[model samples]
Target: MASYRGAPYIAEQLQSILKELGANDEVVIVDDASPDNTIEVIRSITDPRIRLIESPQNRGYVRSFEAAVAASRGEYIFLSDQDDVWIPGRVAAMVVALESARVVASNFEMLGGGPRPWIPRLLPAWDRKPIANLLGVMIGYRAYYGCGMAFRRDMVPVFTPIPSYVHESHDLWLAICGNLSRSITHLEKSTLLRRLHDSNETPAGFRSLGRIIAARVMLARLILEARRRLKR
Candidate 1:
């Protein structure tokens, strides 16, 4: 988990993750210099499976994720935000789904103690697509949230240390890899209760048309780079 100033909900998130962890499983929380009590709350949880690492400087969400996942020793890695509530069976369900695939994504509900409806206006994404089609789907619309994503360590070569200029974070890279493997699976059950609030890094919807277009262009560049890396 990569966190920044998540004091209010970090404790709850930690508790939920800890409950689902198995005897051999471990939870690693990497703090990106939150400038808040998020670290304190994480330390308060006295679980041997839970390990906390503090970065010397704040590197934003993308770098934080890279750092956390790189340090983890798990064969499979689950990424979560600092402020969401995950339901039970998340780890087990994903593990089962991943048995025959390289990666798996679960459904999640948007929340913040109320209902808010708004999606990106520029491009509509497919619920499911072939690995070849996933690049376009991701460029046009959002599919996986960081919290709802999990991948095997074998994917580290492609997903990690995400290119510096990509428009988004590692989530997109992971999605691209999932599609490339032609084994992406989506669980219909909602295991994540995603809380939306003022502090969210991403807004509920597109903020401007120019921003959207710029994002698409950046994503196009990312796809080009990915092809070169994948030798496609």
Candidate 2:
């Protein structure tokens, strides 16, 4: 989990996630030099399975997530957000899907019963359609939230050292890696309850035409980079 000024709701989110984990399971949280008492709230949890890595400076959530994935010792790694609630059976379901695919992406519902986002939910039928999925990702049609995604340990090399130009949408980059490698699974059921608030990192509003065009260019470059890394 990557945290930044998430003190208000992280404790509840942590409780939701920790309950689903087994004795040997671990939760690695990389706080991106949060200004709030997020660290203190996490420390109050007092769980041996929880491992917190504090960043000396604010490096952004992308780097924080990269550090968390690198520090994780598990065979299967699941990405998480600091302020979301993990649904029951999320781990088992995603892990089961990951048994056959190198990466798995799942659906999510609104936490407080707000209206759903403009992006549609992912369907099981679209699981292995790499070309179509890549197109969906490029055009902002796919719902590939990092909090609802997981990948195998072997994908670290392919997904890491995230392109220096990628300042946002790190989750989409991971989805690109999975698709380019033709090793991604799309789960049908929702995995977590996403909390949408003003402080959320995800862009809730529309972008200008210039920003949209730039994002498309970035996605194109990301696709090429993924293919280069996986030699696809």
Candidate 3:
């Protein structure tokens, strides 16, 4: 998990994580030079399994997540947002989901917010649904949210050095890479409560023409990579 000024919900998020994690599993938190008490709240947690990595400068969310995953030693990594709350049995369910595929994206509900955004409606059926066209799914309802997803450690290296052209979302890039190279499955169950408030650091919403063109180019490359992976 990567945090910046997440003092308000980081404690609650960490507590839920600690409750769900197994004895050997650990939670790694990356602080991107937050101006608030996010780091202090992380330190207050007395769990040996919780590891905190502090960034000297604000490296943004993508870099922070890549760094955190790189520092982790788990075979499978479950990404989480600092403000979300994981439901009971989330870890176990994702672990089981990871047994068949490298990446697993699931459904989630928003709380204390107006409406849930990016709720997948027109996508493939969600019964461990294997998304063959990663970019195509993204065009409609791109519900590849990190809070409701878990991926294999191998996926880290596949998309780690994220290109600036498609750097808008690490989760999107990772989902595309996983679907193209390995395997990606979507579950129907909601695993977490996504807390949306005025202070959230959501990326810019309006899509410009340049972004559309860039995405088209990126999709072509992903298609080529998918074909190459299929032969190998």
User: TM-score order of candidates, best first?
Assistant: 2, 1, 3
Any runs in candidate 2 off by more than 4 Å, and if so which? none
Poorest lDDT segment (10 consecutive residues) of candidate 2: 119-128
lDDT tens digits, residues 87-127, model 2? 99999999999999999999998998877787888888887
State the lDDT of candidate 3 residue by residue for 160-213, as single tens digits: 656545554667776777676557767777788889777776554678889777
Using Cα atoms with residue i matched to residue i, what is each candidate's TM-score against the true structure?
0.88, 0.98, 0.86
User: Which tens-of-lDDT digit does each residue in 134-184 have in candidate 1?
Assistant: 655555544566788888887777776688875355676777667666667
The pairs that clash in candidate 2 are none
Model 1 off-target regions past 4 Å? 111-128, 131-139
Write out the backbone clash pairs for model 1: 131-179
Candidate 2 Cα lDDT to native: 0.92
Clashing pairs in 3: none
Candidate that scores best on lDDT: 2
Please give the lDDT score at residue 25 for candidate 2.
94
Two-way lDDT contest, 2 vs 3, winner: 2
